[model samples]
Target: MNDQDITLSRRRLLGSVGAAGATGLALGGATGALAHSAAQEEAPTALRSVGATAVPFHGRHQAGITTPLQAHAHLAAFDLAPGAGRKEAAALLRRWSRTAGELMEGRPAEDDTAVGRDAGPCSLTVTFGFGRGFFGRTGLRDRMPEALAPLPRFTADALDPDRSDGDLWIQIGADDGLVAFQALRALQQQAGDAARLRWQMTGFNRTPGATAQPMSQRNLMGQVDGTNNPKPSEPDFDERIFVPGDGSPAWMAHGSYAVVRRIRMLLDPWERLPRGQQEKVIGRRKGDGAPLTGGTETTPVDLEKRGKDGTVVIPANAHVRVSAPETNGGAAMLRRSFSYHDGFREDGAPDAGLLFVAWQADPLRGFVPVQRKLDSGDALSAFIRHEASALFAVPGGPGAGEYVGERLLDG
Candidate 1:
């Protein structure tokens, strides 16, 4: 490669090394040698191109939700420290917003962490949200939307309270793992004495340009997931996913509700099922994610179609059938999720699943009804476990010189 290409390759190598360090991956002789050789060669376009991809922190809505999914992400929740109330929370958010905006533009925060310097912004996005309990902690209960109420217990939930909810939530995403980690670490440091981490979850999706061309991402279960997610191009997308300004609480205008779930896939059982049986469970083709009785991934599912034997083509209890908006009074949510693999469990099974994050204007109409149906008898529920859950009200993107939740926290 030429001199310029070599410089880019070296940056890619450094980025890889930073990722290894972030993940606590020890670099031995063979790995180090391999990394050196790989660095000499041209890096993938995705790696080299990502450093130039930047998402603005100030917008009509937060960046992470609508921005295409990044390859790496960190989801964290924090509880306010004792004696830290609305004033403290507001100041913290201000600090965070300033830091997020700077970092997202490939600039270091006032307190620099060199973790992401060599890397471009990689479309870094930092989104903030408030949990239901946050209102009580900040003495702003009257500002809390009824939609922010705790989700009703689901039959399939084996929730860990310790990792469930908190007063504040932060979502950091970037194509590069180190960049994402750096942002997470910086935010945690910025929290100072105002808040302490309650729980955090790391997740990932396919890197942009990893495949030959763009396509939908697949979850751990190997299904092309999120095919039905609402698109910005859709006429009613905003209405369906964002709270209207006319809603009761003025502070929440243009905001959205996020339902986050740590779902553990029962891989052993799920993998053992025959492909046909697996298709029956999800009601979609494994290879292309098309509806079983459909033409393409986006083709409307014909739930009524049946086989010669007079059985439903997409099983009655199949996931797609149960969760389809049509079956739920046209309810919809914009699903943007990541796959997580946290190594093996004590029982030797893989502890991995989808980090399901769905955004909607209202959870009661968006997630609750659909999930309740799934709880009753969605075929796919048998192969997955809901281990932790949280719901947060994510306000609209901050305007210039403002931080997220400024209205509720300062008004």
Candidate 2:
């Protein structure tokens, strides 16, 4: 379409954007009047500034690990087709990587679908990783990182075997739904005979510019989540989240380990609690996510502060207290998570919660320790169920002429 036509199309799309019960930029004209049709034709799209944004496929590390959360996401796993081995796996990675590289640039892949043909890149990212089963299936068991070992069972776990583990994992994210879906569909088609889909989950976060200003996102439970995530500026941020350049296994050098969990939040019971009680469960003000111990959201939590009644301000079993780094020997994980809702269950409770993807140099020092402590006494556990889990070794990003996992696959 020509520039004028494109501008007019977007104006119409924006005019009808808002839905009764939707998140993100649902409505453009809630109170203010919208531009007349004639004027709209001369105006630009609201998303025009951010639409052309594109994340480079090649980098020191994969895009999604530390990349800011996108508006839409698709998390999927795949098992190698029967008889597929190292050579097949390597070939599949090449094909998948090529398609991923192209799609992230807002271009159609070799096996193209027109689903997102008219959309911009939208800052699309496609990340690839390998689960524990991947090494064995490809005759590379000796090279599997210890960090990819099975996660120890937790008290809150009610895992589904079918959806838990896979030989391969892919995380696709984008500011626009269609862009994310385009990557997911293209990669799945590229897998062809080498890998078969195991389990897939679609998720979303508040769309970019959905609010007056960017801030920590609220989960389905209506709580500000991930308030204390490790910032990239911290001196130890890279060491905590990604392996050292000279780290073990050689291939995992710049890579990070990802612990993927599908935690289902039981909203019925949680919402029933008085607002006061709900805040106690998380130990943070629901409005701004500040600790009950006080200050803004970024204020350091004072775990030792007590009330006049001789009780701790932040409850002993509060989720934040039990999961804090200070209490867990400095263990921390970069929680790049997305909220998921799969309608309702047979019992009628909304089957919605978090697609919790935590990244760390090693699970032994990251997710495992903190999760163990949470299992022991986290009050939030009472209202959530751990439904699925998997650990993937995400290798460093590919360079010119290189594909993901190339070092290990060819080692």
Candidate 3:
């Protein structure tokens, strides 16, 4: 019969089965079934999903100048009360999005395309997402809420000591350093003492042609990075995003996992290196992301090939070598790293580098393991140092709510 008829038939069969059982047994069985159903419903999705949008420059700012508009990233964790008002929080987000766009000359809206002037008045666009601990049939689900059915997927996570929890992360971008601080102040007012927020700022000159390239391409090293990242409009987006399961609930199908790293790059040492040596270290041309072994950026790397007297051409411990296909464990993470040019030394020298952001399905298999392997003395490590690191559990699907440890504040 038709799908609706089949559903009705199944309901009738269940009803008949219940009627045939004794009253006491039926009641006990129903309660047990409900508990089982809740447990199944609460399980996190198998794959992480992501949705992202770019805010471009369209106003009086230097279209290509690399040193005017400063960029910064911020993150915070919330210890939400058991009955905290999520609707009010979501309402604040909606209001903030509108106010931020207005403050930036109407450029913060999802579809707004107007670019603002450099070093001029600007607004901020705030993107939101759910973490792994937020999903499922917990009481928090009924309390936490979202304005829309499918929330925008932006990279934001709190600092988790272990890799088991996700933090409520909010990233703010602006033209002026003061503006960034102002945005954070406003967020704190709305969130109150219910949540704790920690933020880091990275200010740099906005480069021309930035809008033409993907977010993952621009790095502090003045190079187009992460050319190997999955393209946004590719057909594989669904596969990379949603978990595989016919019985999976509709709400959790479109969520993604997020990972954040506060990496400090030693630019002086790197810039000191001869351009040729730099190229060799990265295993690719600095100007273009082409492999040293030859071919375009998209070409598969020839990692197995030997150079000269049978030594590996790319080298076993090179940044690209360790991060490449040879040691990635056959898993790919969509990276959207941002160059942060702040935290200068006492002598007025540059000290900051990149806020490395990556998204994938499984943190253990996808990011953690790969990073652990790379930490074993890769060439890139010479120029870069991991000053701070944390893992966040990003939840997937609809009706997914705030993180698990969030209710600790209520206690």
The digit string of per-residue lDDT tens for model 2 on 218-316 reads: 999999999999999999999999999999899998999999999999999999999999999999999988999999988988999999999999999
> So what's the TM-score on candidate 2?
0.90
Cα lDDT computed for each candidate against the true fold:
0.85, 0.85, 0.47
- Per residue, candidate 1 scores C-alpha lDDT tens digits across 98-186 of 98987886666888686776676777899999998889989998888999888999988999999898999998988899889999999
Error of 2 at 172 (Å): 0.4
- The per-residue C-alpha lDDT of model 1 at residue 144 equals 86
**TM-score of each predicted structure versus truth:** 0.89, 0.90, 0.58
Cα lDDT tens digits, model 3, 128-185, are 3444333332335543323212222212222334422233555455544554555555
**Window of ten residues with lowest summed lDDT in model 1:** 21-30
Name the Cα RMSD for model 2: 6.7
For residue 281, model 2's alpha carbon misses the true position, in angstroms, by 0.6
* Decoy 1 TM-score against native: 0.89
